[model samples]
Target chain A: MSCLGERLTALVDGELGHEERDRALAHLAGCARCRAEADELRQIKGRLRGLSRLPASDGADDLPTDDFLTRLRSLAEPAAPAAPDDASGTRPAHPGTLGGQSTRPMRQPVRGAGPGRPRDNRPAGRAVASAGSGALRRHQRRYLVVGAATLFLGLGAASYAAGGRQEAPAVTPAFDRFAVEHALTSGDTPMTDPLTDPVNQIQTSPGP
Target chain B: MTRYTGTGRARRRALVAGGLAGALAFAGTVTGDAGPARGVRSDPGAVGLLRAAADAARRVPYEGRRFLTTWNRGRSATAEVAVTHRPGEGVRYRASSGAEGYRPDSAADESAGIVAATLGLLARNYSVSRVADARACGRAAHVVEARRPGGGTAGRFWIDSETGLMLYRELIDATGRRVVATGFTEIDLDVPAAGPRITLRPAPPARGADRPDPDMVDAQAAALAPWGERLDGARLARLRSEGWPIPKDLPGRLTLYDARSDGATVHLSYSDGLAAVSVFVQRGSLDEARLPGWQKTVRRGRTVYRREALRRWAISSGNGYVSTVLTDVPQSTAEAVALDLPRGGVPFWTRLARGARRLGSAANPFG
Candidate 1:
C-alpha cells in the first residue's frame, strides 16, 4: 500500500505492526501539518459524538450544524480511496470553517439524495437535531392551547358554583309562600269523638 | 158605736198596705230581680242554646252500652261497646261483638279505646262557639266545631237543646268524608247518680307477661320496620350535623303500640310525635288498601313519590311501607324527617296487608 493508504488503514483499525507503525509514527511526529490535520479529524469525531446525543429535531429551526458535516463526510468517503488528495483538498482546515461560505456547496450532494434516503435517514446527528427542534415547536404550541383551555374551564366552574349559591334565596321564598297558603286554605277541623258521626258506627262500634 | 167604726177603718187601711207589699215581693221573685227586670223572658239564640248544651254535657258524668250496626248491601255487622265516665280519670270502655270474629283479640278493639279517650280529652278542651247553630235529631241543637290549630282533622258536636246532652258527634276527614258516625239512639238524662256499668275487662296479660310485651308495646314500630331502620344513628347524626333540631317534645302527642305477625314475621313499633321505632321479620308484600276519602298526593324532586293521606297528616301505608309525620310539627320539619327515613326499606306487600288488617279491625268510636 502507499504510505498515506497504510496510515489511513492503521487509523481506521487503531493499530499498526510495531516496526512499520514506528516508521509511520516517526513521519507523523516530524510533520506538523499532518498532525494538525489528524487533530481536526479527532475534533470532528468528538463533534459527531456530541451530535448523536442531541435531542431529535421536531421542527426546522432546531437542526444541528453537524448535519452539514454528515453530508460532507458521505460525499468525501465515496471518493476517498480513489483520490485521497482531492478529498483532502476539499476538507475545511478547521471545524468552524464548515459554517463559512466556502463549505456551503458541500451540503448539495446529500440534499440531492434526499429522495432516496428520506430526510430523517441521513445520519444520526442530523436526524436527532431535526426531531428535537420539531418536538420543541410542538411543545410550545401545545402549552399555548392548554393554557387557554384551562383558563376557560376555571371561569366556567366558578360561574357554575356561583349560580348554585345564588339560587338558594330565590327558591326559599316560594316554599314559604306554599306553607302559608296551605295553612290558610286547608280546612282542618279538630278531631271529634268518632261516635258523633252516625255514619262511622262501623268504626266506633265495639267488635265482638 | 163611733169608737168601733174608727177601729174597722184602721184595720182596713192595714190590710190594704199589707196587700201592696205582698204584690211587690211576688213581682220581685218572678222577675229574678230586686229592681224592675226587663226582657228576661225572651227565648235564647240557637247559638246560645248550643253553648249552654255543650256546657251542660261537659259538666255531666254518664256512660252507656253502645251497639253499632253497619249495613252494607244485605250484610250487617254488629259491634257492642260499654262506655263509662269518671269525674277526673277520663272515660274508659271495652267493646265486643260477634261480627269481627276473625279478630278476637285484635288492635281493632283498641280503636274504640282510643276514640273514647280522645273524646274525654276533647271534653276538657272544648269551647262551643256562640256563632254556629244547627238542628239535629229533631232537637234545636247547638253545633260546635273544634279544629286543631296547625291544621288537622276537626270534630263537630251536636248537642241536644232541652237536655244539654251530646246527641251526635262526627269526624270530618281531610277529604270531607264523614268516615265515622256515632249518635245516641236512647239517652237517659239524670242517669241515676250511679255511674254506668262497664263490662270490659283489661285485656288478659299477654302470655308470659309481667308487663305488656315489648313487641306488643311497639307493634306499630315493628310493622314500620326496614323503614324505621332508616332512622338509624348515621342518619340522625347527619341531621344533627345539618343543624336540624330533633324534636324531643310536642303537644298532644299520640303514640301507637303495635305488634303483628304475618305467620312468618313479627313487627313491632312505638311511635311518638314524628319518630317511630320499627322492627320487621320475614319478607312481605305491599299493596295499597282503600281508605275512605283517601286521596293521592304526589310530591316531586330528587325523590318522586305518591302518597295517600287518610287525613292531611295521616299517610296511608303503601308498598309495604306505612309512614306519617306527626301533624303537630312544622310541615318542612316533618317532611325533612320523613325524607330521612329509608325509602322502600319496608317489605311493602306485607306491611300493606298488615295495615289493611289494622284498619279492618279498627273499632271506630264515632261509628
Candidate 2:
C-alpha cells in the first residue's frame, strides 16, 4: 500500500467507498506524517464551516471567533475576493491533499485565499526561520571541531600514501640460481642463471 | 696347340669367380639365419649416440656461446649465455644484464644430478632414432629424436661428430611442439689443456656457489626422510595406515616415488624415469599474495595457479592442503600431478601453522 495522496482527501470529504475509506483511515492511523497533514486539513475545513454560521458570542470558543475575523477582514479589506463559490453558498473546492504521490486533486481555494495571488509570506516565514537559526547556533562549534579533525586526518593519510610511490615494490625473478641449476643438469659448468640488476653486470673469470 | 695354355688360364679364372660367388651366398644364408637371435631394438643408432652424448657432455672441456629457448602455452623465450667449462668439474655462464632481456651469471654444480641423464631411462617409453643430421655451433651433429612407442616424439638431441658432445637438445611435447631447446651458438674446441692456445677464463667467485634450488630441495627432502622401522617401509605406510588418502599414481604413467612430511609441507616426488615432478603440500588455502603474475585456471572443479618459472612449470591448488607440483616437464603433467594429489586428513600442526601464518601476517603493521 503506497500513499493515496488524493484518496485521503476524498475519504475526509466522504467521497470514498466504505472499503477504501476504511483502508485510508487505517493507513492514516499507522503513519504519523499522513495523520498530521489530515489533522491540519480537518481544522481548516472546520474553520471554513464555522464561517458559514450566523455569528458567535464574545465568550465563544477560538474557532468561531478566528473564522469570523478572517472572513470579515477578507471582505472589508482592499484585496481581491478569494472565491465566487464562497459568496454563492457552494462549498469551496480543495486545492491540494497529502503528498508523496502523483494526483490531479480538486482545485479549490486555501484559507479563503484566491488562486495565484501575490501574498506577503515573508513576515510569518521570518519568525519560524529565526527560531530554527537560534537552535542551530548553539551546536555550531561542535560541527566545526569535528570537521577540522576529519580534514587533518584525511590530509595526513593522503601524504602517507603518496610517499610510498617513490620506490615501487616489484617482484624480481631470481635467475642466477636457475642458470646454475640448468647448467648443472645440462652438463656444462652450472653458472647459467644471472643475478639481479647491477649485480648481474659483475664480470667473472673463467674456471681454472 | 699354343693356345691351350691361354684357354686353361681363362678356365681357372672362371673357377675362382664361381668359388667366390658360392662363398658369398653361403655367408648371406648364415647371417640371415642368425638375424633373429641377436634381438632387435628400435632406434639403436640414435640411442647409442645419446649415451655417448651424455658421456661427452661431462668429460669434454670447451668454451662456447650457448642459447636456451623455452616454449610454453603458445609463448617462447630465448636467452644467450657465454659459457666456460671444465669436464668433471663445473660450468660457468655469463649473460647480458639489461632490461632489454633476462640473463644471469650463474655456476651450476655439474654433478650427475639431472642433466647428464642416460638413454636407458628414456628408452623405457621412447624409441631413440637418428632421424636426421644438423649443423650446430659450427659443427656437424647427428639429430637423435626420442619418439614414443605409440607415436609422437618426446625429445631430440644433436650430437657433434668430432667430440661426441651434444650440440643441441630439444624436449618435445605430445603435440609435436618443442617445449625446450638449448645449444651453443658458437664454440671453441680447445681449452683446459696444456698447450699454447689453451688459456682458460678464470672461474667466478665461490661466494654463493651452493644456492639451493627449491625444486631439488623439495625432492631431496622427501627422498631422504626415514619412515620404516621394522617393515623397512612403514613410516609413510604408518601414516597411510592412519587413514591418509595419499595416492600412488596420477592419470598418466607418473608414479609417486618419495613422500615425506616436514610438519608443515608434504613433499612427494613423482618420476617415470625420464620426467621428474615434485609435489609440495601444506595445510592451508592457496596464497593469493604470492600469485601476482601467475595465470588462474579452473580444473576438476578447483582453482589453480599455473606459471612457468625458473625453467620449471608449476601448478598450485589448495583447500586444506595447498598442493603445488613443480616440474621441467609439460604443464599438463604438473596440473595432473597437483590435481590427483591426496586431500583432507590434514595434520593438526599443519592447521595450526596455517592459522599462525595468517595471524602473523595480520599482525604486521606495515602491511
Minimal lDDT window, size 10, model 2 chain B: B221-230
DockQ metric, candidate 1: 0.01
lDDT of 1 by residue, A43-102 (tens): 765675466447463333223454555556445544544644432323222221221223
- Against the true structure, whose DockQ is highest? 2
Question: Pick by lDDT: which candidate is best?
Answer: 2
Error of 2 at B164 (Å): 1.8
Among incorrect, acceptable, medium and high, the docking class of model 1 is incorrect
Interface CA RMSD, all predictions: 19.0, 14.1
TM-score, cand. 1 vs. native: 0.27
| Per-residue accuracy of model 2 over B176-196 as CA lDDT, tens digit each | 888867778788877854344
The local lDDT score (0 to 100) that residue B205 gets in candidate 2 is 31
* Per-residue alpha-carbon lDDT of candidate 1 for residues B164-272, written as tens digits (9 for 90 to 100): 7666656444444444345554444545444433222334322221323222432111110011122444544453343222332222232223333322223333232
Worst 10 residues of 2 chain A by lDDT: A98-107
